[model samples]
Target: MSNINLKTPVDPKDAYVLVVEDNVSNFVLIARLLAFMGVQKCEWKTTGWGVVDFANTMSRVDLILMDLRLPHEDGYEALKQIRTDPHLQNTLVVVVTAHGSSAEMHKAREAGFDGFLSKPLDADRFPEQIKQILNGEPVWDLGI
Candidate 1:
């Protein structure tokens, strides 16, 4: 994991964020924003199939930004697996996707996402939102 020194509203330097996104551009954008938010350790995975293995390798993870639509396994299925895993059951898993319809959000909630942040996240407020979620607050900003 690489370290960054960007100023943010909150100190998320200790936070470890894993972004499960198949799209390279989207992942880059999210990683850049997280770095800008002072998040020191940010990892990426292109498919949902690797999520469990990745989680198994990590001792602890602060958050997971899961894209609802993935190549092999969908985000919902991945979330179910993650929730069932003893090691990662309590980890924060937020749905980060472009599908921000109310119905989609509801389904994501029912599928057990800790929070929901729509795509094209507001750069100015992303850090604050993440900070709140890290502090045990449920954030549901669909941005619709």
Candidate 2:
């Protein structure tokens, strides 16, 4: 992965993030953003099923950037599996999708997402949103 810095004053290398998006463009965008944020440790999974498998193999996963709509399985189902898994139950998951709505946000919350971000995600605010999640803040509102 090419080195990119997304954070202004923060170094994200110390942090680890897993981005689960089926869309290649979206995955690239997320990976770039994380790199820009100074996140040196970032992994990618193209499907919900892949995410489950990856999570099982990973020793430490700090955060998960999950796409709401995906082939094979949706984010909701994947979230359910993650939450139910004894080992991964505590992993923080942030739902990322273009289908942003009050209902969807509520559903995400119900599914136990740690946070939510609308698609076409603002690169400018991406770092802050990540920081907020890491700080144990729930960013249910896109206004964050």
TM-score of 2: 0.87
Candidate 2 residue spans exceeding 4 A from truth = 1-11
Candidate 1 yields a Cα-based lDDT of 0.82
Predictions in order: lDDT: 0.82, 0.79
| Candidate 1 residue spans exceeding 4 A from truth | 1-11
Q: Which one wins on lDDT? A: 1
User: Which lDDT tens digits does candidate 2 get at residues 1-144?
Assistant: 111222332336777788889999998998888888788888888889757678878776778899989899899888888877776777778899988888898888876787889988898888888877766666776553
Clash pairs of candidate 2? 4-35, 5-36, 6-36, 6-37, 7-36, 7-37
Error of 1 at 105 (Å): 0.6
For 66-128, candidate 1 gives per-residue lDDT tens digits of 998999998998988888888787788899999898899888877778889998888888888
Question: What lDDT score is found at residue 97 in candidate 1?
Answer: 93
Candidate closest to the true structure, highest TM-score: 1
